[model samples]
Target: MALAGALLTGALAGCGDGPVRMGAAAVVGDDRISTAKLDQAVLDCQRQFKNDQVANQVRAALESQRQQQPMSGEPADCSPRSALDTMVNFEVAEAAAKTAGVSVTEGQVDQMIGLMGRQAPAESIVVALGMPKEYTRDVARMNAAQSLILQKLGADGNQQSPASLQARQQALSLFRQAAGKLDIRINPRFGSFDENRMTVSPVTTRLSATESGVR
Candidate 1:
């Protein structure tokens, strides 16, 4: 139900107007995901992960899962860069949904959250995924849109089924096409956009070893 694995794919081609706005993390079509929004999402993640004990517990659980399945690449950390990645993903998914004539309303999001509550604390799930509580509705809507898109592509939501796999591929293709049409751009301060992965990579910096570094 999460948008985590759904939005990652190769970059698409599109154009933007004028220059990117100052303090904007990324521009999706005419809309911008501002730095302030990115900061808030990162703060929410920090607040949730601040307790060392709980953070370790969650990290350990995730590590165990990774060991069993061996994910293709390193997992993203709960940092501002990753928050920006998530923001862009949702924007792209929304664009794709619009193109596919899929709509997810607030009531539908609430219903989905209620359904998910049967398995785990919905708030915990949202926070653990580095999404702000205030943005829970948006997250739910994004998930619903993704589900609808897959359904339209003939997926039954059984992720392991061949039909589901084919649907996922088609859905990703649609997202990529939508993203290209939208002409999304990211600020270099956060990272460069990896069209191959459809996510931001942390910028590399050369720190002077002799200079006083913050601990």
Candidate 2:
């Protein structure tokens, strides 16, 4: 979710050209992220969200202390389409990595998750983002790839620096160019996919936003 550039969550955009292929939530190059897979991830987030809700209700009954579950209230946002967006985003990040000549190993991904675990249980880290606990490795790979992409491009990670800002724009441009060449498409049920912005617009706003013109 922290990829470089402006990822628009504001306006709705029209769906891309051509069909998204049956049962596939998205198609990133030859990789098919299936609807069943998206459903599983969404269901996982909902389960966690529901657990948080129930925990809150139980704690409300307590006369004294608050619940101390570290992973309880993640993903402050859980729209049904959100998971699909993330799944697609992860794939896009991987594609971008290949073009950037950056490669991530299993150990690197494990280390990434290990670092995240210091904050919260690795399994509990991404429920709020709608990623299934089983896909934690995928999320880590995305994070690793994004970090390496910026580093390779000489983009400073510090947000306040002008050089970093310019590097971020450059990174974004690289992602957009990579996306333009892939066979990427999103299922209408999940709204429209904007490759340049790497966002999925919901069905309600698909017709109002301008097309990203990505193939």
Best by TM-score: 1
Model 1 scores worst on lDDT over the 10 consecutive residues at 5-14
User: Candidate 1 lDDT, tens digit per residue, 1-215?
Assistant: 22322223223222333445788888888888999988988887777766544444555566677778886444534688777777887888889999999888878888878875575566555555666556667777778899889999999868999999999998888988887787877765676666556666666444333332434
Of candidate 2, the 10-residue stretch with the lowest lDDT total is: 2-11
Alpha-carbon error at 164 in model 1, in Å? Answer: 1.2
Q: Report the alpha-carbon TM-score of model 2 versus the true structure.
A: 0.73
lDDT of 2 at 195: 65
- C-alpha lDDT (0 to 100) for residue 169 of candidate 1: 91
TM-score of each: 0.77, 0.73
- Model 1 earns a TM-score of 0.77
lDDT, model 2, position 6: 25
